[model samples]
Target: MNSHTAFVAAMIAAGMFVLLLGTFYFGNFRRQKPALWRYVADIDRAGAMIRRKEYDEAEALLAPLASKSDAPLHIYQLRAAIAQHKGDWVVAARHWKAARRYFPDDALGFAGGARVLLRAGRRAEAVRMLEGARSRVHNPSQLTKVLAEAAQSAGDWAEGARLWEQVRNEAAGDIDSYVRGHDCLLAAGRPDEAAAVLADGAMRFPRDPQIVRAVAAAAPPGAPGPA
Candidate 1:
């Protein structure tokens, strides 16, 4: 063929290829859209069932999703929640680990597993788990907060105070950290540090009744107080 004829033929072929690709892409997306909606609906239904304490029903609803090879993180989380509610610590831990494996960047599984282990009276295990996962977590603040809670539960007042202080410093808007940090420092017999923490919270949350009361009570003997 002539050079001009060859160029025209090549252009026509390219247009046909582009048209075919667009057709296939849209067709597949349309076909998958309903499945995606159904998946979301199922997740919502399972969540409601879990909230109602219907473990069996929630599990049943999630079974199909769980069987899929590409199951999302929430599926494992829901499974872990169900297991935890049923007092199946081993199964719950396994599901949490699976979630962590499936979604490596997320801290939810590590936090959830640690909380469950703590609730099961495995304080050391909970601490160890969080410490081990700390380096891999996308957000260490979440894990740090849970570690602070674990410290409080274990009566490690010094450690709890330090962890709470770290938590409050790393993230803002958590009034619990300030209150708990003060309480922990007091328990550890550091009244000055305790007072400092409470004073900081009072400054940040001037209108909060709890902080106001705490600050008033935390005032040193014979010291001037908030007006």
Candidate 2:
């Protein structure tokens, strides 16, 4: 064929392919859009019900959604929340574990499970659970912070100090990290490390009264005062 005729045919074929793609995309989107909205709306309603202390209704509302083959991760979270509020630690743990099992790459399940365990005063278990899932969760600093707190609560001061330092390394701007890390270090009988943490926090947050006080307290009896 001549170049002109060949070019025209190619252009028409490209146009048809583009039209086909657009038609399929928009048609699929239109079909799924309403279901997406309803799914979100139901999740919101269930969340509100849980917030209002309507555990039974929240559970009922979430049950059908959870039964669906492609149920969202939120369903398990909501169910766990309801179980937690009702003081059913066993059920809460189960749902949170299910969330982790179903959504391995998400941090919410592991973090939420650790939170529930912390609330139930199972500090060591909470730490262990989060530690095991450390490699799976994305952006695991938040879980690291939780583990730090859990270690502190369990009186595992050495572990707490290590985890808190990890948190501080991940997020230098987190004031709690410096304060908690320093405290845990002190509790673990590491005076030098504690002093170092306090000094760093004092330098970064010079005006923060907590860190300022910590620095003053850590100073030697004959040392020069803050100027």
Candidate 3:
């Protein structure tokens, strides 16, 4: 062939080689650079195992990943959840505590740890942890409810009543909180205070049978009618 044609052929081959190299480089960059995608994939896989009720396998898969990365909050959270489900309150508490360390701002992590601590009968510790968490939480009604229950279980009826009242105020129209608050107040031996709480609850939930019953129950047998 002519030298001109040979040169053109060589140029086309070189161009193809450069295109192939570029494609390979980009593929490697996507796979090796950043690395977050692979970590995310492992998290997803562990989540799927959790959904399938394969707690052991899920924990196995997540443990190493959690240890390997700083962003493994979800992994630690899932491990805590699994441990709680398995009735290993101590293990759950440890995992949740680890998760909180990695995500100190995570309300759920602190809440979970508090729950496990309460279940393990570490009421005072749970209260302290939850109280600290409460200040950090933007919306703490649910966590307050949990703390209330924990305090009640630990025979701190007064503290339970206080927590429930706080939860009731934060709920702002939640009938369940009103009902729980009334019950907690009565249990705390503040019957008169319970009566007042119930009266206010009746105003908010006028048609709720539970609220009406709670108010009636809070009153003494010969006490005056609703105030």
Best by TM-score: 1
Better of 1 and 2 by TM-score: 1
Q: Is candidate 2 or candidate 3 better by lDDT?
A: 2
Q: Write the per-residue lDDT of candidate 2 for residues 33-54, one digit (tens) a residue.
A: 2244558988999989988999
Error of 2 at 77 (Å): 1.5
Q: Which pairs clash in model 3?
A: none
Q: For each candidate, how many residue pairs have backbone atoms clashing (under 3 Å)? A: 0, 0, 0
Off by over 4 Å in 3: 1-53, 57-75, 173-176, 189-227
Please give the ranking of all candidate structures by TM-score, highest first, separated by commas: 1, 2, 3
Shift in Å, residue 22, candidate 1: 22
Whole-model Cα lDDT of every candidate shown, in order: 0.84, 0.83, 0.76
Off by over 4 Å in 1: 1-40, 202-227
Look at candidate 1 and tell me the lDDT of residue 50.
Answer: 94
Error of 3 at 214 (Å): 7.5
Scanning candidate 3 in windows of ten residues, the lowest lDDT window is: 27-36
Q: List the residue pairs that clash in candidate 2.
A: none
Give the Cα error of residue 13 in candidate 1, in Å: 18
Candidate 2 versus the native: TM-score? 0.61
